[model samples]
Target: MKIAQICPRYFPDIGGVETHVKEISERLVKAGHDVEVITTDPTGKLNRRETINGVKVIRFRSFAPGNAYYFAPQIYFYLKMHSFDVIHAHSYHALPALFAALGKSERRLVFTPHYHRSGHTAFRNLLHKPYRLFGKVIFSRADSVICVSEYEKRLVEADFRVAGKTVKIPNGINLAEFKHLRALQKDEGIEGKTGKEKTLLYVGRLEEYKGVQYIIQSMPELQEFRLKVVGKGPYEAELRSMAKSLGVEGRVEWLKDLSRRELLKCYAGADIFLMLSSHEAYGITVAEALAAGTPCVVAKGSALEEFVDGTRCLGVDEPIKKEEIIKLINKLKDMKQNSRFTTESLTIFDWDYITEEIENIYNN
Candidate 1:
């Protein structure tokens, strides 16, 4: 089977959707299916066309100046000219995905909307209205609509009124990799932090909507733990200022652009993983944390709440109070110390299982 994955961005641009496309596309290629990715060169630096890990990637010039929502007209033309067994579009908020939906293709159109009803800021929220109007038409075009979480599926059904042919297929992790790391992992504490101070890890783009500010705000009350922030984004400067203003700058360490191995080690070593996003389609890092046998505390109303079974994971509502976060952290730490912490079974998130499900969608 020949498959075309249409997304706004691809490799080297790290995010949940990018990682999802890369993992499934590579696995599909390994399974003897021909796979190609069509995305935009947001940075204008990546090769226009290249084959990586047996999967072909084609990036077109795009007009994505600041915000990640790219505008690529060529993708529509490319879709009209090419033929494939499946045309899988990702991220309803991105224009390239919308264009892929609009393009005339006889192939079965499988769409993973990655939908979030609103955005982080008022401006982005305003922009969502137009995107939603566009997405209604895109949803109509999909032969099968793939949602990453139950929350996303509900939003798609409620907002777009998508009835049948909508499937809930959550994002997956490389279970083998995490298992290997767990096997060989040593108790190497955080790279620089001394003593056995509890380690709190936040790994993802440091965007404002990600709710990193809430964590930083709570640091004044959480002086016992060291916060290690991984990943870079536009919101770094503001977060830094907030940390300094709160006089907790010394407790927070900002690490950016870590390699995959280093990141897994961080997940393995951290005492607790924090994903306090205001809006998340699915918290892939939370799954990664669980796979590493690390406990997680996610935002209450986000899609992550569905995955947290309250054993190794906990959820707190948005605008989370400092005292509440501190209490949860303390509870998780006690649970860890008592050896009573057990992560949710993450076999559902294994890439092998996830890819098989995606293959079935394409075949059907």
Candidate 2:
């Protein structure tokens, strides 16, 4: 089968959606399917065409401001010209999906919105109201509307009225890679720190809606624990200044450009992981933390809450109360001491299984 995996960005630009597209595309290729990723490159520096791990990747120049809208009209022209058995559009937040849908090809159309329901900032959120008019095209044209979480599925159904076409195929992870990478970084002396008791981990883009500030504010009382933030975004400077003003600068470690092995080492070395994003279609990092046998505390109301079963992970409501969050963090710490972390129930997220499910959709 020849398939087109279309999205706003791809590998080298890390995020939940980027990772999802790359994982499924590569797996599809290994299954003897011919896969190509069509995406935008706002900076215009990346190659217009390239191949990574047997999957063809074609990038087009885009007009991206605050790196948000990703206005790339050439995408429509590209899609209209290409031929594929299926064209899978991704990320409702950007315009690439809209262009893909507008192409209105004869092949099957599949859409994975990875919808956040709204935007991360006031301006972006406001734009969503108008964007909804265009959003309908992506959903209405697709043969299948794939959602990564029930949280996302509910919103898609309620807003788009595509309940009949919508399907849930939650994001998947490499269950073994998390465990295998646990010992790689430290053994090679790439990251020299040890004795990480009471360490806290936060991994994702440092966006305002991510609720990372809430964690930074709690640092004074969480004096015993040091935070290791692992990702980059527009909010880094602001977060750093806040840390400095709060006198928690010494306790916060900002890291990015890390290899997969080093990142898993951070996950395995920490006592607890935190993903406080206001909205997420799904939380892949939280899944990775659990896969590494690390306890996690995630924000409620997103798909993240689905991972909280009161043992390996917990959920904290927004308005992120210091006492409430701290108590839960301590609770997870105690659970770790009691040997409560387990992966027996996490096989459902295995990438192999996830690829099978998606392949079923493409074939049908």
Candidate 3:
């Protein structure tokens, strides 16, 4: 089968959608399928056409200033010219996905909206109303629509009335990678840290909707823990300012663009992982944390709630209060020594399992 994956951005961009496309595409290639990715070179620096891990990646020159909602007219022309067995489009809100939907393709189209009705700010939320009308048309064109979570599936059905075609298939984690890391940690006799000054980790884009600010606000109270933020984004300066204002600057460390091995080390060393995002279609990082044997504190009512069991995770209300966060941290501290933090039940999110499910979807 020849599969064309349409997305706004690809490899080295460091986003959930980008990671999803890379993982599934590489696995599809390994399974003897001809896979090609159609994306935009947001920086205009990456090779326009290249093959990575047996999958061909074609990046169009984008006119947009930043990576968000990239505008690439060439994508439409390419889609019209190319032929494939499957046209798998990601991120419903992205322009490339819209072009793929609008393109005249005879292939079976699969859409993974990665849909969130609103953005981190008020203006984006207001725009979502009109976007819903456009979104309906996109989903309506697809042979099948994939949602990463039950929460997301409900939103698609209720907001866009596309439930009949929508199916739940979650974002996955590289379980073998983390298992190897755990083995290395044990062999090296490297336990995270022994006493006080627990390592608290937050890995993802530094964005307003990600709720990194609330974690910074709660830092002054968490004297025994040191916060290490991984990943870079526009909101870093603002978060740094908040930490400074709160007088917790010394206790917080900002890390950006760590290699996969370094990231797994961070997850392995973490006493607790924090994912307090205001919204999440599916928290892939949460799964990664679980696979790394790190306990997580995620937002209540978000898609992450589905991934947590009481033994390994604690869910707090959105706009997380400092009091509750502190309370949860104390609970985690008390249990850290005894908690197993195993990934035994997270096999469902293994990339191999997820890829097989998607293959079945494509074959269907």
Candidate whose lDDT is highest: 2
> Per-residue alpha-carbon lDDT of model 3 for 3-113, expressed as tens digits?
999999888788889899999999999999999999998677999999999999999988654336677878889988888889999997667887888884677889998
lDDT of each: 0.85, 0.87, 0.84
Each candidate structure's count of clashing pairs:
0, 0, 0
The residue ranges of model 2 lying beyond 4 angstroms of the native Cα positions read 181-197, 338-344
Native-vs-model 2 lDDT?
Answer: 0.87
* All candidates: CA RMSD (Å): 1.9, 2.0, 1.8
Candidate that beats the other on lDDT, 1 or 3, i.e. the better one: 1
Clashing pairs in 2: none
- lDDT tens digits by residue: candidate 2, 1-364: 9999989999889999999999999999999999999999999888899999999999988898998889989888987887888999999999999999998578899999999788988999989999999998888899999999999999999999999999999999887786666466446643312454368889999898887888898888887798999999999999999999999999999999999867878887777789888889999999888887777898898888888888878999876777788888878767656776564666347888998999999988
Candidate 2, residue 189: how far the Cα is off, in Å: 8.3
| Candidate 3 TM-score, true structure as reference | 0.95
Q: Tens-digit lDDT track for model 1 on 145-196?
A: 9999999999989988886979998999888887687454654443422246
TM-scores, in order shown?
Answer: 0.95, 0.95, 0.95
